[model samples]
Each structure stands twice: as C-alpha cells, then as structure tokens.
Target: MADITTTELRQRLQAGETPHLIDVREPWENEEASIPTAQNIPLGSLPEKLDDLDAWKDEEVIVHCKSGSRSSQAKAYLTQQGFSNVRNLLGGFTEYSAG
Candidate 1:
C-alpha cells in the first residue's frame, strides 16, 4: 500500500480524474462531510463488502476516513486481499476538509 496526501488527491479530482475513492468512515460521519464522489463502506463492513470492491481490485483505490488511521488499516486490508494498487489518503478527510 502507498500513501497519498490530501492535496494530491484533491488536485487529481479537480483535474477530472475519477480515481476510485473509498470512504471508510461511518454513516453519521459521512453525513457530516465527505468527498462527494467517494463510496462509503464503513471500515467495519469492509470485510463483508469485498465483493462490491472486486471490480476495483486492479484499479488504483484511495481509502480514507476521518483521520489517516482507519484508512491505513483499510489500505492494508485491501492490499492483503489482492488489491494491487491501494493507497491510504494521508490525513484523510480531516485534512481535505481543512484545506
């Protein structure tokens, strides 16, 4: 797994690149604020939702949570599951929101 800073991700999105973005935050947290294009799958449910991500297995997936911690775990999990190109959004949504 690799690390992608919030600025980099934001810049990519602004450039109209639709990289796969997965939000590992819970429902309520997502309701507060989230990347509009990110798919929400809360960290706890990720294991059960593996099939839902199968299509992205070979794609560049960017995982994020409120802070970087949860997303790091998510990135590791996805990498173990054979996701070849997974990245943790460094500083996660907190940094994105702040910027």
Candidate 2:
C-alpha cells in the first residue's frame, strides 16, 4: 500500500474512522508524544511481538516513528512477514504533529 499522509490520517480520524496505528519508536519517544490509540512497539521488539500483531495481519496497520525511517523499516518487515495491508505514515509523527 502507498504511504498515508498525516493529513489523510487526521481526516480519517476526524471522520470517526478508527484505524489500527502502530508507533515503532522507542518507549521514551512514545512517552514524549503519542496518539493515545496507537500501540507503541519499539522497532527492536517487533520480532518478539509478531504474534501480538497477527490479528492485524490482513487488516490495515499503520506504522510510524519519529521520522519516516524507522517506520519504513517496520513496514518492510511487516510486509515480508505476510502482512498484506501495512502502511507507513509519511513523515511519521514529525508530520502528524506538525499539522
């Protein structure tokens, strides 16, 4: 799937659509600023947490990080692991919070 812009995500949430969002930043980074509904699973821990995300395998799972880099990696990993609908948040939280 193509990456989603923060604006698009904001619009979806404003429209009352609840999408599954994953924040792949560090615990400290997540604590600093985070979307309450987004689950924080630090990038390094993703391997161990694969089972926790199997439920969302075929679902639209949005992954993000401080910038777009880490989430990009997360998206790639998830996609290779059989997740068909994973999307990286364009610009990550940096863009999301900017708006």
Candidate 3:
C-alpha cells in the first residue's frame, strides 16, 4: 500500500493521468461532493465489486472518502485482496475540496 497527497493527486489528474480513482464514500456523500472522474464504489460494496475493478488491476488505483479514513481502509482491503498498486488519497475529498 502507498499514499499520495492531495497536491500530487491533483497534478496527476490535471495532467490527464488515468488512474483508477475509487470514491469509497457513501452515495449520499458522493452526491454532495466528489472529485471529477472518480468512480463511486462505496466501501461496503467494494468486496462484491472486485470483478468490476479487474481491468484496473495492473493500473494504479487511488482510493478516497470523506475525510481520508475510509479510503485508508479501502486501500488496505484492496491490497490484501491482491491488488498490486493501491494508494490512499491523503486528506481525502474534504481536503481536496477545501484546497
């Protein structure tokens, strides 16, 4: 497991890097706010949706949630499930939106 700061993530997104961005927050939270291009995969459903993310197995996957905590858990879970590359967006959407 690894981590990327909000600054780095923003730069990557701006550069058109296509990382598999996973929003692990709940649907309502996502509806209120979200980073552009993020795919909602609420933390609770990630286990059942592994097949949907298979195409991103070889690519870098960046997970994020409301305040970064959930995203950390999501990243660990994905890594344990054999994901080769996973990163938690440090400070998550709250910080991203603020900055």
Candidate 4:
C-alpha cells in the first residue's frame, strides 16, 4: 500500500480534486472531529462494507483514522479485496488537524 501525507491531501482539496475519503474511525470519533467530506465507515465494519465500496474498486481511495494504525489495516484489507488504488493517510487526522 502507499501513503498520502496531509499536505498532499490538502493540496488536492485546494485544487478541487474530490478523491474518495473514508474515515476508519468510530462514529463517535468521527462526530467529534472529522473532515466534513469524508465518509464514515469504522474499521470494524469494513469487512461487511466491501460491497458498499464496490464502486470505488478501481478508484483512488484515501483512508484515515485518528492516528495511522487503523487506516493502515484498512488500506491493507482493501488492497487484498481488489482495491488497486488505496492509500493510508500518514499520521491520519491527528497530524492533519495539527498542521
């Protein structure tokens, strides 16, 4: 899997590139602090949500969590499930928000 830094993501957003973003944090965590455009799909539910993401099979998808741990697992899992363009947001939302 590959990694996407917050700077790169921010630049993309500024450039009007609406890439698919999945927040792999829990509902509570997402509600507390989130990228408004990111879709909420907790890590635990990813297994059952594969079909829901079928449309993004060949699309670029960025996954993030509070930190990077959960999203790393999500990226690995998605790649195994035939997602060719999945990336883990380095340092996740924590670093994204900090900067």
TM-score of each: 0.96, 0.97, 0.94, 0.96
Write one digit per residue (lDDT tens) for candidate 1, span 1-99.
558998999899999999999999999999998896999999999999999899999999999999989989999899999999999998889999999
Model 4, residue pairs in steric clash: none
Number of the candidate with higher lDDT, 2 or 3: 2
What is the model-wide C-alpha lDDT for candidate 4?
0.94
Q: Write the per-residue lDDT of candidate 3 for residues 1-99, one digit (tens) a residue.
A: 569999998888899987789999999999998899999999999999999898888779999998889999999999888888999999999889988
Q: List candidate 1 segments past 4 Å from native.
A: none
**Top TM-score: which candidate number?**
2
Worst 10 residues of 4 by lDDT: 1-10
Q: Cα deviation of 25 in candidate 3 (Å)?
A: 0.3
Question: Per-residue lDDT for 1 in model 3?
Answer: 53
Candidate 1, pairs of clashing residues: none
Candidate 1's TM-score: 0.96
Which order, best to worst by TM-score?
Answer: 2, 1, 4, 3
RMSD of each: 0.8, 0.7, 1.0, 0.9
What C-alpha lDDT, on a 0 to 100 scale, does residue 15 get in candidate 1? 96
Q: Which portions of model 3 show Cα errors greater than 4 Å?
A: none
By lDDT, rank the candidates, best first: 4, 2, 1, 3
TM-score of predicted model 3? 0.94
- Count clashing residue pairs in model 1: 0
